[model samples]
Target: MSVGGGGNGEILVRVENLKKWFPVAAAGLSFAAKREWVQAVDDVSFEIAKGETLGLVGESGCGKTTVGRTVARLYEPTAGKVVFDGQSIYELPAEEMRQVRRKIQMIFQDPYASLNPRMTVGDIVGEPIDINRLATGEARKNRIFELLETVGLNREHASRFPHEFSGGQRQRIGLARSLAADPSFIICDEPISALDVSIQAQVVNMLQDLQEKMGLTYLFIAHDLAMVKHISNRVAVMYLGKIVEVADGYELYAHPVHPYTTALLSAIPIPDPGVEEERRRIILEGDVPSPINPPSGCHFRTRCRLAQPVCSEKEPELVDRGAGQKVACWVT
Candidate 1:
């Protein structure tokens, strides 16, 4: 399903019928070479406004990250169109794509892993500037310090190694590096998932502040529904490599139509004891089906509590139900 209507600014990113599949090869004597396609991200479509946060939520292995990577052109999509800034990203030449890269950046999930342990924090953050040839000599150093300060880090910290900093600080460094390229769009791929609960809030708030001050757009991919609700302007729920439900943040949480979206919302813990006790938790039975061979028709039908005969017989296309909400369920 897609969000309709474009505003004043040209659509910064438009993903149409995107798909990413990996081949799974059989082990043992089955080395006779049967290839099964793992549908990581299938036929997903969406558009991100010039300055908006589109939070993509799903359980692990639901291909949220794959979608972000595919859109970022980190992974060559098996099939689909990725139009960024009015140009087809996949069709662009290497040199043209390199220029586009400056406009789009990524903040990785793991602060520790994403930062190279061997490199100094200054080097780590400045690498982008150096690669882009944006600045040099004292000018480069000044730019690095400015980035560090922008992300709430002191210039002195740049001299230290990543191993010396806390997880939250490392994430700040990652943010600094991302900003060094002066990108308008950033793919925040679960940037806070690895931090402590307290640290997570700090990092998230910093990102919000940066967005406000810089007018940055984001494709936030995370499994944390509560955090997504807090940060996102709009949200998209993914299942089996497809977007099952998409709506404004408050709208989606208040009136989730898709069965899978309902189940996910039910699982989020309510702080109020009375509400927590009264809420019925939707415990989805059966494991998620393998992407290599997802179920026919509705991918969620296998475990959907409200599934009907038609759900199993035909795939539901995402249809608009008014109020800027789209759902892909037969019952909805």
Candidate 2:
């Protein structure tokens, strides 16, 4: 796979102080009881430059998907601003937002569940065209076929049902659908996670090819560090709901500052037996703390081996650590 460089340009998607908290209510007793908010995403801020792919990597339930969904306007953020192309997306009215939706699209995690079973592959891929009124009849059908071919699928397969295809094929179909409207920004929420291990490289390569050809920007959210390193220009390591570190992909892998980032990179399996044996695995004890009632200051403090008293007392703001990298750990 060829790694492409990002061009200098204005920010395409800017998420400032983003927060998405889901309410969790008690099952039993009174219906009028107050609900507790699950802090899915808390005070997260980042910017994606035009034509840049910023991979958001973290463990499951770290609110990566929530951040992506909130940016895509699928879920209304509890607070903060989502600015797209110099305009505040959250502030847009329904009519205007409909147009904004065309430029921003999402490829969900589950390809099988994301596609409509009742609809054929043609309708599934052409739904965006119909909604945006970009094309109709023969023109729309031709566009759908074009998209299918773009994502490595044959035009003939467009008429088949999604259930008839394999997992990888379904994901390619999903990609074709997302590209139907020619979106500039795509939120790839673990798009390859559900596919076979062998097919993961193919999907990643396809995305990389499409990004270069179409000048597409991606908010690539996934837990696969290896894949992220391969495809992303830069990567943001997220812990709890906040981004702990952000740096160039190679730089972050070579010189990870945050304890959490260090531990995550250490876990990536090495191919060479001797090298793997020599590498030290940094294991953090215990599960991630509940988002509803997270630790007082640094969320990772509970599992952090280098945690000091000050870590629990104050939250660490993501600060520049020289060389265009930012880290949010007290020790770092």
Candidate 3:
């Protein structure tokens, strides 16, 4: 319930030096070719307090979704730790980890692809409940209907399939299913990117309401900077599989420290014509370096306008710059 993730200093989720790398086959048909690794998430560290929403924003291929999946334990972490509710999840046994899973859930992007076409809305929402053995018979049915109505869907529509509903409705069903687990922390990975503009607001508002009611913690991942600013207590900017800056929503937007964060904030358009015309956009040169073979020092230095000699020789650590704002830049 705090503004900048400072709620009694109680950390519900802590990710430390997390890394997820996938093996990429060498090009062409060669027996002796070396297999390379695509560093999707590299040494990413952050924390989400109880009842706090930490928005993770970056461009496509920035490994935001991968971070969410890794935290949810969908992908086996190549390195580092993911601690949930004071327990190290990766180190837990199978049965113990199964219990931990019920407390951590993920709402994936692409509502259509995420849901099973063969399953009805009711079945999709109730699957988690059944898996966890939370209820049965009439009790299970009532729980499903309650979840449906809670997400602003008609109880009668439960009998219908995913194809029978619109995109927004399908997303609502996804929300219902995530809630079915009675999760304490939910990773929302671009949950609204596939919906209409108006529907995006509706779903986001509903998420805020549910978080308030259920006292849930969220790691909201998305490309919508404005939306992230609106929903998140704190925002973390990622680039080239690494977090560049982390700060309070207001502080980050008003005064971005990292060069990449400043450029990203500049790209968000202003509605007012006068302000839009006067605003100076910091357009960086060069494309984002490949994660497979990132730059020597700072991954962002190749595209950064303020890149100095040291930036290419030494990678900067994420040092706190008062008021809990952390930045990984030599020049900042």
- Taken over the whole model, the C-alpha lDDT of each candidate is 0.91, 0.90, 0.91
lDDT of 1 by residue, 172-222 (tens): 999999999999999999999999999999999999999999999999999
Tell how far residue 131 is off in model 3, in angstroms: 0.7
- What clash pairs does model 3 have? none
Of the two candidates 1 and 2, the one with more favorable TM-score, higher being better, is: 1
Residues 174-220 of candidate 2: C-alpha lDDT, one tens digit per residue? 99999999899999999999988899889998999999999999999
Question: lDDT of candidate 2?
Answer: 0.90
> Model 3, 144: alpha-carbon shift in Å?
0.4
Candidate 1 minimal-lDDT segment of 10 residues: 1-10
TM-score list, all predictions? 0.97, 0.96, 0.97
How do the residues 210-308 of candidate 3 rate in per-residue lDDT, one tens digit apiece? Answer: 999999999999999999999999999999899999998899998999999999999889889999989999877768777898898889998898999
Predicted structure 1, TM vs. truth = 0.97
CA displacement after TM-score superposition, residue 246 of candidate 1 (Å)? 0.3
Q: TM-score of the candidate numbered 2?
A: 0.96
Clash number for each model: 0, 0, 0
